[model samples]
Target: MFVLAVILSLVTAAVFAAAGLAKVQGAKQMRDAAAHLGIPWDNYRLIGVAELVAAAALVIGIWLGWLGVLAALCLTLLMIGALVLHNRAHDTVQAMAPAIGVGVLALVTLLVRIAA
Candidate 1:
């Protein structure tokens, strides 16, 4: 269970780090996504920063499980917001799958963090 927690934490952190970096860099696709979600560019970039912070917390959480739990909870909430925004934009389920999938992973990581 401890090993599982570590692996999940690293994988989740990596995904968020890449995604956050793209958003912070204002990649074309991320810009388009922000527009689609009706969020201002600055606010969207702030969201990216939040993701980066959470990813860092998860990395530090390898030794301190409580931080991992906190980070996972934060990611889960962020993903929930993403799902809501996608729905409001009338996006297809395919478009929402990544958020849903990552949200599930975050939730699972949270549970593992607790158990471990």
Candidate 2:
């Protein structure tokens, strides 16, 4: 169970880190994508920062147990929002995969911790 939590946390961290960096470095692209999704550009930086923070929390949480659970919850919510944004942009196929993957992994990590 501990191992599963560690793996899940690491995977979630990597994904969020990449996504956050893309949002930060590729602001124009992110803005375009957000526009397509009907999201305001004003929110882009905030979202990027949130993702980066959440990713850090997840990694740090690994050593802190319950913090990991909270981080998982945060990442789960972030993924859910990502799915909604992608869907709004008519990107259902692309959106579903990562959203589902993250959701399942987070859920599994939560369950494993609970069982332990």
Candidate 3:
């Protein structure tokens, strides 16, 4: 279970880190998506930094159980927030799919850690 949790955490971190980097890079797609979601363009970099921090914490948590658990929990919350934003914006499945997927993965990792 621990091994599986670690693998999941790593995968989640990678996905989110890429997303964070894209936001920081001001990728056109990400900017447009954020705008569509009603998020201010000025906050894009901040969101990206948050994601980067969460990603780092998640990977570090592999060695420190508490850190790992905390990061998983935070990621789960972030995903939940994403769902809410998508719902509020009445976004299409295509827009919400990534959030749903990442949220589920984060929830799984968090649950597995709790079980352990």
Each candidate's lDDT (Cα)?
Answer: 0.94, 0.75, 0.87
For TM-score, candidate 1 versus 3, the one ahead is 1
Top candidate, metric TM-score: 1
Which residue pairs in model 3 clash with each other? 61-68
Report the lDDT tens digits of candidate 1 across residue range 1-116: 99999999999999999999999999999999999999999999999999999999999999887899999999989999999999999999998998899989888988998899
Ranking of predictions according to lDDT: 1, 3, 2
Query: Using TM-score as the measure, what is the rank order of every candidate, best first?
Result: 1, 3, 2
lDDT of 3 by residue, 1-116 (tens): 88888888899889889999999999999899888889997786788888899889989988888888888898899889889999999988897998899899889988887776
> Estimated TM-score per prediction?
0.97, 0.79, 0.93
Q: Roughly what TM-score does model 3 have, to 2 decimal places? A: 0.93
**lDDT by residue for model 2 over 3-116, one digit each (tens)?**
877887788778877778888776677778768778676687677788788788878887777877777777777777878777766786755686678767766666665554
Which residue runs does candidate 2 get wrong by more than 4 Å? none
In candidate 2, how many Å is residue 49 off? 0.8
Each prediction's total of clashing residue pairs, residues at least 3 apart in sequence or on different chains, is 0, 0, 1
Once all C-alphas are superposed, what RMSD does model 2 give against the true structure? 2.3
Name the lDDT of candidate 1: 0.94
**lDDT agreement of model 3 with the native:** 0.87
Error of 1 at 81 (Å): 0.6
Model 2: lDDT of residue 81:
82
